[model samples]
Target: METFAEVLIILVVLTNLKLLGSSRATACIRTVAAQGVLLAALPLVTSGDAITLRMIAQALVSGTLKAFVLPFLLLRATRGARAGRELAPFVGYTTSILLGVALMPLALALGRKLGVTGPAGADLLAPAALFTLLVGLLIIVCRKQAVTLVVGYLAMENGIYAMGLAFAQREPLLVEMGILLDVFAAVFVMGLVARHIHREFDTLDTDRLSSLKG
Candidate 1:
């Protein structure tokens, strides 16, 4: 179980780097979906030998949304908006990747300093969660398009979900349902706004919004 958790955490870390380095919006969306699938498996490994029905429900619901529903929403939004690559970010792609690489050591050190570990099998979740949060923040600040920002928001949301896994045994199923509902609402709203923005502005670049008079 410990080894499973470690491998899962490492894969999550790799997805973070992939998100930072990827330019094609479709590729980024797929990578985030992959991360969702990995995280959905997280509870099973961390549950040790006494896995519950509730955990299975949570993983199934979470995986369906993260891997399929959310990505499909984003893809539909992208098609509606005619969105493409993340061009003209405030920070360049190369720099973003370099920064992502640099953040790993810092996250690992901070994770250790905090001395927090996930229950039993999930010792490496802390650093991986932190890395994901930082990468999401980086994408949020550096990228210019509304679609990319939505992607970043999802990544940050995933990070928070991962942190919650440290206390998975104690969290109620109701709270998990609430989190999923909130996430779905947020993405739905963001997708609508992005499509509208493109309809009016002819581009998804959020920097174009400053030209609006009202």
Candidate 2:
């Protein structure tokens, strides 16, 4: 169980780095989807047998929504947006990767100082979660593309979901489901807005939106 959890954490961290470095919208969306899939498996790995039939069903629902449903929407939006990549980011890819590398140690140290309560491999969870969260924030702040912002937002939510599992494994099923639903709705709305931007301006670059006077 510990080993499995550790592997998942590592994958999540690697995915975060991949996201930071990626400029292609399609690749970024795919990485976020992979992150969601890993997050879904986290519960089973961290909590040995607290798994009820309901829990299993819940996992399937959350996983399917994050991994498939949401990405499909974003991809559909992208097709209409007609943008292939984030051509210019406020922070360059190299700098973003450097920041991610630096942030990892800080996250690990902070996690240790904060004294996270969980099992053996759980220590890794906090750092990985924090690292991913920061990476996501970086994406949101640095990228100019609307689609990239959506992807980054999902990445942040993924980090939050993973940390929630690590810290509150026994949280009620309803509460977990609620979080997933809220995220689903938020993503849905964001996709619509992205599509609207494309329709209105024929471009998905957020940089252009700033030219609006109102």
Candidate 3:
């Protein structure tokens, strides 16, 4: 179980890097979908022979929503937005990758400071969760694309979900489901806004929206 946790953590970290480096919005969304899938598997890996029906349901619901439903909405929005890749990001791709690399060490230090040993006390798990959360924040702060922002939020939520497991905190199934639905609602609204931007301006760049004034 511990070994599986370590491996899953490494994979999640790699996906974060992938998200940071990729400019194609579709590719970025796909990367986020992969994160959702990995997060869904986390419960089973950490169950440690105590897996229950609730755990299975949570994993299933998380996988269905995060991996499938949400990404589908984002992809549909991206199509409507008619933008292929991020351009004129506040942070360049190279710089974003550097920040991602730097975040891992900082996350490690933070985990140590918090004395988070992780489930089964695995040293890498907690820090990796923090690293993922930071990477998502980096995406949100650095990119101007609306779809990218949604992807970043998903990544951040993924990190938070992972953190709960890393710190051995399990949320009730209803609470988790509600959080997922909230994200879904937010993304649906954001998707509509992105499409509106495209319809009004023929582009999905938020920086351009600054033209809206009193």
Q: On a 0 to 100 scale, what is the lDDT of residue 155 in model 1?
A: 89
Report how far off residue 143 is in candidate 2 (Å): 0.3
Model 2, stretches more than 4 Å misplaced?
Answer: 212-214
State the lDDT of candidate 3 residue by residue for 1-214, as single tens digits: 7888778878999999999999989999989999888978887887688888888888888888878888888888888566788878999999999989988889989967887766663678778888889999999999988889888988998898888887777776678788878988988898888778778878777777785689
Residue 182 lDDT (model 1): 93
Tell me how candidate 3 scores on lDDT: 0.85
| Candidate 3: stretches off by over 4 Å | 212-214
> Between prediction 1 and prediction 3, which has the larger TM-score?
1
TM-score versus the correct structure, for each prediction: 0.94, 0.93, 0.94
Model 1 residue 65 CA deviation in Å: 0.6
lDDT, candidate 2, 1-214, per-residue tens: 8888888889999999999999889899999999999988787777786667876887799889988999998998899566787777889999989998998898888767767766556678877787878888989999988989999999999888777765765568788778888998898999999999999889888888776686
- Candidate that scores best on lDDT: 1
For candidate 3, the 10 contiguous residues with the lowest summed lDDT are 116-125
**What ranking emerges by TM-score with the best candidate at the front?**
1, 3, 2
lDDT, each prediction: 0.86, 0.85, 0.85
Off by over 4 Å in 1: 211-214
